[model samples]
Target: MDFSVRTVRADEWERARDIRLAALQDPAAPIAFLETYEGASAQPDSFWRERTEGGSESGGGRVRQFVAETSDGRWVGTVSVLVERPSDEVRFGAPAKVDQTHLVGVFVRPEARGTGVIDALFRAAVDWSWTLPEPAIQRVRLYVHEDNARAAAFYRRFGFVATGETVAMPGDESAFEIEYELPRPEAGA
Candidate 1:
């Protein structure tokens, strides 16, 4: 593909908001994301501004969002990662026993699916995770809805193995999300 993948800019919140709304409208959003179109659409512009900036390259570095933009300047896909720490007051899934990155908000425009965009976006996200300073991120993880076979298969192909942990989906407790992780490659191995 001719698209370029990079961390989002703090100043591009509008674009970020636009792409996210598009993602929430995808047919699989119910299984793929925790937020709904109605909920997201109701958020004020300030909410999106903070949300985008929090994950931008110039943001605090605890989170990052990557986007694939075509040569014509259209964003075709996106993926976001949040740093999780053992001492954090809140937890997304199981408390992090070690520093880790939680991958979320993965999506691609239908027309852009299966064209290598997802692979490139993941490379950016995971590679960024490996470069964290200090103790260094021990692993990168993501949760897939139990019934989302397509996402699970792709995650496996990308080297994420189930850790045998499952968390009830936020809104639908009847459904669950399975956790997957890719431990950092050992140095000099």
Candidate 2:
């Protein structure tokens, strides 16, 4: 399938909501995402609007959501990045000790698995993270549920390594999420 990955626009909030709802329905949603389908689907239109706006291409460099859209306009995958700064309050897990990007909200439709759509989406997201102005991001990181082998394998193949850090799942203390990191490439290499 032919697809192009690009940062979502602020006006495409409805599309963003639709894709998120679809993601929450995926089998891995329970461990892969922090929210449930029921919880997210219950949100009002304004909530989605604000979410998309905050993650849109013009979100003042705080966040960016990349979407993989097919030739016919269907969205098949998405990945979002949230910029983390040392002085900024932590949103999840722990406070940032240095400038970094947190990868989150990753989802690719079931049918699109192994189709390279994910690779395309990550290219857009990682490229965006590296291009930020002064205080360039030192790395990009994400948390994967310890039991999510599929996701962990993919992250490893994509060059992310475990950082020996783990955090208890927000609402489920019995399980933990492990941290993975991909340090920034050296200058000119």
Return the top candidate by lDDT: 1
**Candidate 2: residue pairs that collide:** none
lDDT of 2 by residue, 14-105 (tens): 99999999999998999999999999999999999899989986778699999999999999999999999999998888779989999999
Clashes of each: 0, 0
Computed on alpha carbons, the lDDT of every model, listed in order, comes to: 0.94, 0.93
Question: Residue 81 of model 1: what lDDT?
Answer: 95
Compared with the true structure, the alpha-carbon lDDT of candidate 1 equals: 0.94
**Which pairs clash in the backbone of model 1?**
none
List candidate 2 segments past 4 Å from native.
none
**lDDT of candidate 1 over 1-189, digit per residue (tens):** 579999999989999999999999999989998899999999999999999999997789999999999999999999999999888755568999999999999999999999999999999999999999978999999999999999999999999999999999887889999999999999996
Error of 1 at 114 (Å): 0.9
Candidate 1 deviant stretches above 4 angstroms: none
